[model samples]
Target chain A: MTSSTTEPIKITSKEQAEWFLNQYDTFLFDCDGVLWLGTHLLPRTKEILNYLTELGKKLIFVTNNSTKSRLTYTKKFASFGINVTEDQIFTSGYASAVYVRDFLKLQPGKDKIWIFGEAGIGEELATMGFESLGGIDTRLDEPFDATTSPFLQNGLDDDVKCVIAGLDTKVNYHRLAITLQYLRKTESVHFVGTNVDSTFPQKGMILPGAGSMVESIATSSGRRPSYCGKPNANMLNTIISAKNLERSKCCMVGDRLNTDMKFGVEGKLGGTLLVLSGIETEERALEINEAYPRPKYYIDTLGDIFDLTH
Target chain B: MTSSTTEPIKITSKEQAEWFLNQYDTFLFDCDGVLWLGTHLLPRTKEILNYLTELGKKLIFVTNNSTKSRLTYTKKFASFGINVTEDQIFTSGYASAVYVRDFLKLQPGKDKIWIFGEAGIGEELATMGFESLGGIDTRLDEPFDATTSPFLQNGLDDDVKCVIAGLDTKVNYHRLAITLQYLRKTESVHFVGTNVDSTFPQKGMILPGAGSMVESIATSSGRRPSYCGKPNANMLNTIISAKNLERSKCCMVGDRLNTDMKFGVEGKLGGTLLVLSGIETEERALEINEAYPRPKYYIDTLGDIFDLTH
Candidate 1:
């Protein structure tokens, strides 16, 4: 853990940047606001990535948005004229699949997960040899029959040992009911939410994200799902476990304080860099939850490091 | 308002029961647990009611379950071979309608409310000359077109100034999406939840109640809804406003601590009574939340009052 008693310092000087660069070999970058907003790439981020790559630094893209899989994110990176492989992306969905397979210790082929998300979550779990039930377009088409008590009705997939919730545009009552049924009817089923990011920054505007989806199941069921996203630091740990990286030689770079900064701080990485390119302004950063971990450093943008390169 | 320095006293004697019964001429009872378990009536409850009637005590039935309207509840009483008037019953649906009409101060026929519940909530709102939108049996039959964003398609009701949520068996993504759209997409829209009762006791088993139904909209919308059910004290206040009853002369009697006991306690009624005939067992009563209102007295059951009357 980063046992630093010191507060986050402003990374303004070249010497500070040089010292920071020398400390970490692996860098995790938060996409959306930090890298690009929607289709438009942020200024100097490409140059920064190229500079880091030239130095032979390991780069990983992390996002809480589970709507898109690594494959889709790869295309998203390419759309912005940035080169990022699917392997370099660590999504909440991917983390969730890993969590289910590893942490929960559910057998991939035998123990199934009822998914209240899109193909992104499904794809990741599938890649891990796990079957995902009722995802995206696979909505519950069961007609409401007043004559039948759905709880009393049999034929529900008894194999489902987990319910993983994510942002599903096609979320409906039947899906929620089925999920609740899995949680209620079944014994000892694990409830997982990919991330509870209440909103997502996209194209200069914030939109409702995964937290909304998780809220319903939690409220109705009177049960909170174990979240697998930023602020939890599971994503960084997952990367570390997979790649066997030096924990003390890694840094997390992001725009948001609550998730990204908290993730990095809790991970006890070499450093956490907060960029003001997204949701949290410098003024807003002053008022943070006392419980949350603070970033090690704050900068105006990822491009601010250009001064260091100069 | 029950300014008692004394903790809840056990009603173990006739003198204690006499002091309790004599304190409140107006007794509000929670239906499902206090009176009967679904279709089956509890032992000696009818006799206790008969004795209370002999003493000419004013009995009012209050419930947070918005699934059944006062008219439906009247029939439920009739099914139990009990005498009850529609006026004597106050359901969350009735409370919600009253709240919207009197509390929210929304102009009827001008400001509309989108209903995310059953016919009970709809009928109650209708009684108040208010228009209700979606409800039970009103499924969003629209097929998910992956190519299109549901929010972009026009045809959503725009005049809706409020979204009232309750125990909607027909709760689906479209309903939740519409609720979220109103809360997030619309401007200054009111969000109201009928109640947040997590579970309802039925014959031999407990099932998820309206609270579970409300959980989704609250979670997904990222906005907390104003509730009009038991423990909120609004139901009691609504009754007080309509009937102009003496608040000090009233007491709430039920099986649950969170809802029924809290209702009476917060209402500043004479006292609250807990009976061990329903959801909560005597052992569970020992672990009352310090934040919640406590009952003034406890007994084996509502039927246990027979010993006092005798």
Candidate 2:
């Protein structure tokens, strides 16, 4: 829950929209719902971004999606006719690698990292100069047999220092089996998750997110992962240190209440703006409950910022 | 924690063992850690069962493993030279079917039971004369693509009244995707889990259990399933009603503290006997903690009953 005493202010006038834009020097945007949904860009996304850029507001795209690396996100932005560098993209996959390198401080080559996710997380780890395994390996896709499975019979690598889990679409008994073995191998081996989001809206439906995969491994291993995604203090701190931005000059805009709004509010940023283009509804945002987050401001969409200016 | 105020009593002498046996008319036993570990039976299992039969104590094997049906359990029992009727077995699979049939009371031919588990759950539902889908379906084994997956594109059957989840070693994204869709489709569609044991000791390694699968779906769906296995009131109620047994004259013998001991203690059975032959240790059982269950009685192993008398 956010520590806000007052209800979120709705920006309906041109004056309020201008004041909101002028209030922050840097703006952190959540992708998927705010910038685009699935493949189609949200209404007037390009216009809103151009307006922010023209105002000289530093923009950073922070997404909890751990399925893609920063390079892949750069490609996605290119496909949408938006120009963004890898440095401007902060994905949960990248956050996991940063958390391991900066926070855990595992020795790169000597400490092998095991993954229970797609190639995105592995690619991020590789970018950090760490040797990793168990991501997108066809050998792990084989059917599991309790008695005959090699994962159960053969011991895991002792050099494996950490295990990171995210959205593993190729989730099978074998992958989970080896991951559990590493998690339970020793108390020293670290466990990390990209995010804990239960579900995310994609296309016309809500789909299972990385949280499902992380929770499954956590359950079987009787251990909780150090989540490095949105709302987690580590992610905010990492971005703040890397970008060298002032906390009071940064604002977060997102469509999710728990992850995005909570992330901004808990981090004590300049402000948080909620949009109705994604999972959350206006009614839900207005409710005053300890379990629900209260953003500083609300709008119909990210496009509303520029639209109201006219 | 159990309602008992005192610590568990340890049986050491032949006199104590005989008196403990005389106190109960029936005994409910947990199969995995108590009867056998993998395919190998514990010390003097057959002799102890023979002794119980000679004393005219009704024996029931209650296992939380939903992977095997009653018929499959009968075969496993025969393999161990233990003669037990299908009536004497109460697997979590059978309990799930019982909960759906006797408790939910969904119309047999009209309502469908969607399964996210193995063939055992389907077999149990079939035995109860209910039509079920989505168990051991080879079509579910194919790789998942968000846009191209048939499970995502094709709408689920409206006739689905309930979704039952158990330990599915064949767990994949496609199976979970469909299950999430059904869980979020409508409030009327029920979600049920066979058990919630995080891990089970198997082949000298702790492996993921039904709880892992149940938890993954529960997470993605953002809904909790009504668990029908150990420590759940529904399982004890079903067994009590079906067996026509006296609650004050029955004892539960198990090796795991959470599932087995908690099941017996919370059910308010006459007594519970903890054995060190499985997942629990004497040290863990003896420690006093609010979260830890305290059984009424404990011994080194079930075979101690016959050995002490001799």
Candidate 3:
């Protein structure tokens, strides 16, 4: 059996760490649960930020939760006692919007959206300057009363360019019916989902997250949503491009093994820290580590950053 | 517009009627919304039944909704003024149970199950003599407690002989989480969904149905349930066996184009009747007919059965 040592273990042996540190210039972190869960920042999170800042390490907060815009995350981080700008925050929502706009060659103002999500997701679409027909305030116009709203009805027309899924509590029987209807009409219409998480902690209770909602729509519509989140190639590509960092130079830290650790594995990030303060448990960590793309380090909490650097 | 008299109606003419009558000896009908939606039978449903019985046509009722057993359906149909034996009712639940028993090659009582959905679904497994868990009354055991009961939490488990989806309102957060967890662990586990319906008419209001539940589980589990309903091969197989008839000698008559018409196309049934009484609207029928699987006849209702026979 391996020795049960109290000493904080390095992600790599000293020689390996020195070798990796020598090659890597930038680091990416997953917010929510890693930096903080909701409003509660992880202990010593600020110290890690200061240490990274002093080391001149470029840091980017990559989040799959696209229910909030970068501006909102940036502002929220400030409230959590961390100073960050919008440029440092990368969201799958924004990445997806950009991807759809560029790859599909969609004109910014020309494509119409039938979005089913929160304001943050809507804002990201707007930032790309795309016209959307289904938002929180988008009216239930003529031929689509409350009962006929795509949110309420059976089918949406072929003219709909995209169908986006984010966080929407107001999602009712109608939206689902319409989504399936529209999805059946045009398979070419893009189906985008913010994340695949089934539930998220909200106000002390876990609420049905965007994933369940996205799955519902996908199942009903018989269309798979192009997931734009961690572990997805698109989000990883965005991080690589935006940070100007090589894959081998980056490290991802997070509480969820399936999301954060999977991202690190798929992206070929140099290192990953599996913190136990959020979703995955110690048992889950061990199970995950047995697989490929295992995390480089296992920390009881985010405070282990002090032991690693100091 | 062309004159109606000039068009000569172009309906199911006398020659077409004779062709249909001579072609089929066995008929398989779906119960819900096809023969009767809820407790109310469709118009001329009794007349069609009487006519088929008078002609000595072999008939079997197949339903994907597994909330009730064959016996329950037999009783329900009897109350609706149609006589049916338990042997005449075939359910997806029974098909799934048989599939599990055969695939595992397990002796009758050896296999264990962690079932989700209704009593009918569970009863099918029980009938196969499988030791089952995760029913409504099944105790919340350790490690598989309320927080982890795949059925009440998500849908079903991998250890289960089969994870069946029929109809259940208890589909909530806990069920989803556990179902996903079990699915991730075992790929060999079979997924069975009763139907692919989006919504079912309930208490005069359309309600989220089993299809939506199955879809949610499928999305998270990353496995598609082998559907055992209308248009699927299993129902056709069951119909063939139950009626002791060749596939070429069977005709499916129903109200919806997708379900009824697809059955004819795929099952190679002699004829199909697109009845306007239940699900498919006239406009939808026109669009569906243009698709690969087209209906053989369009009827105002089951009352048109007499017109064909005469």
Candidate 4:
């Protein structure tokens, strides 16, 4: 309903936790902040997920990190001793791959995808049977030479039908130069961004996220990319339709307000929950503002649900 | 003057050229597109500059290229057989250095300027007697290791007072990660951008400009950088004050309507001239719109002045 005026209900008691559990049949969780922090899983997070699964609630882990594919995320979950399958993980890389195929309806063999990102996007697209180029190419790491660079001399691959920009750690002038050429080429290929998260928490520090790469590409190409991540509604709808889940019966939980909370509220999910283990704090999130909607429920951490119930 | 409603005058006749020469005592010329196209000089450009110099009118080369310092630009001018001094060249690199030292009032030895750019910005800052770091550092080119990176372990330099972002061909994750660290440090650092030109013409192709780097840093740091290039009154005012010239007596001649023409119009310069030798075409420039001001005058090429007068 009206989220701006409504004060967020803090999940502190057992009755409140019981009400939350009974209200939603499905739960969407943000990975970086909600599920874990860096390499360490937040306390009681695994037990909470297990309890929710035992209660017959559907669980989906949504992450904006485009550097890792679904398989990589599944591996990360396995490492953390959390049983999450690849199908249950919705990374921006997987979402972009799905968008390129299903929404854009690109023919796999006929249409080629150009990547201005890391190996994650390429891996995801490859799994969907799409032939992609430019990701994790060591040649792009070399210093750009106008006279000698292969892209500059030999020209661009003409069959590239789409360009996907994501978090690229090895981003250099050579990579951006070739991407710009494809973006400005005749017959204007589709431009897509895996996500637009400005920064993500890395250990104890904040670092540039995939949004930085997307903005860089957008600036050079003078073209805005179609985003396929959280807060865009595209990714949420895709997940909903693929799993045949009702939006009214689903609850979204995340640590960030702009991406995760907005993703839930705008998508008209049943409820939105905020966890204080990631980028946002309880003080900042509770500050009533028009910029971002306050979450319906707030908890000290994602593990608070387990703590309250058990 | 209501430039949106007014049509740009095409200087085709000798009488019109004489009128233009009489109207302005000082001319601000954009280097890349106005004077030379890449390393090659346009036809009669040398002759035009010679004639203009002989006429006793002051000429200032205002360029948004931050990759090269004023000394480098002067050398470029010399290589082209054009007699020009370092003071005559006002590059974005030089302008940014001045902004940090003069406007920001950063004292030498006490305040350090961190550069997220090429050698040009460091060169300019060094010329001003300010100690700088991080520009063109080969160590940043190495693959980022969260565990082994020195910046991740030791933290950032506390003396870094300001961060200057310009066109950096060697930009990598390590560089951005370090810059983001300084920006998010307890003592906030001033963020400055050399220019905001989205793309620059490179030989035959267009590539990512300094603005792309600027936007990337801004997105990650969640801080907007103070731009010191075209369309921003800071650079124009700096030049005007340094030269002790009246704004009404100077005309800005450039190829791009957004930056060059907007700079002139917004700065309240005497007039603005558009040249067709660079990125823009006649058809696009002539299209009357409010987004960009119609130039007071336009020519087929910068050399048209020499042709008209001769």
lDDT of each: 0.78, 0.89, 0.67, 0.88
Better of 2 and 4 by lDDT: 2
lDDT of 1: 0.78
Better of 2 and 4 by DockQ: 4
Each prediction's interface RMSD? Answer: 3.9, 1.2, 5.3, 0.9
Q: Give TM-score, chain B, model 2.
A: 0.97
Ranking by lDDT: 2, 4, 1, 3
Ranking by DockQ: 4, 2, 1, 3
In angstroms, the error of model 4 at B275 is 2.0
User: TM-score: which is higher, 1 or 3?
Assistant: 1
User: For residues A79-153, what per-residue lDDT tens digits would candidate 3 score against the true structure?
Assistant: 977899998988877777766776566777677777777677778778888877564654422222334454545
What's the distance in Å from true for residue B292, model 3? 5.7
lDDT of 2 at B288: 76
Candidate 1 lDDT tens digits, B98-190? 888888898888778888888899888877778777775334535423224354356556777788888766555556555666777665888
Greater lDDT among 1 and 2 belongs to 2
lDDT of 2 by residue, B65-114 (tens): 99899999999999999999999999898999999988899888889998
Give one digit per residue, the lDDT tens place, for model 3 in B1-310: 1111111111356676566666788777767767887777777788878887888888877776777878788889889888888887888777666666654454556556655676777787777677766545434222234444435456443346556666565443444545555555577666777777666654345555678877777765667888777667777776576457777777676665566667666777766656676776766655433333545666566656666666
Highest lDDT: which candidate? 2
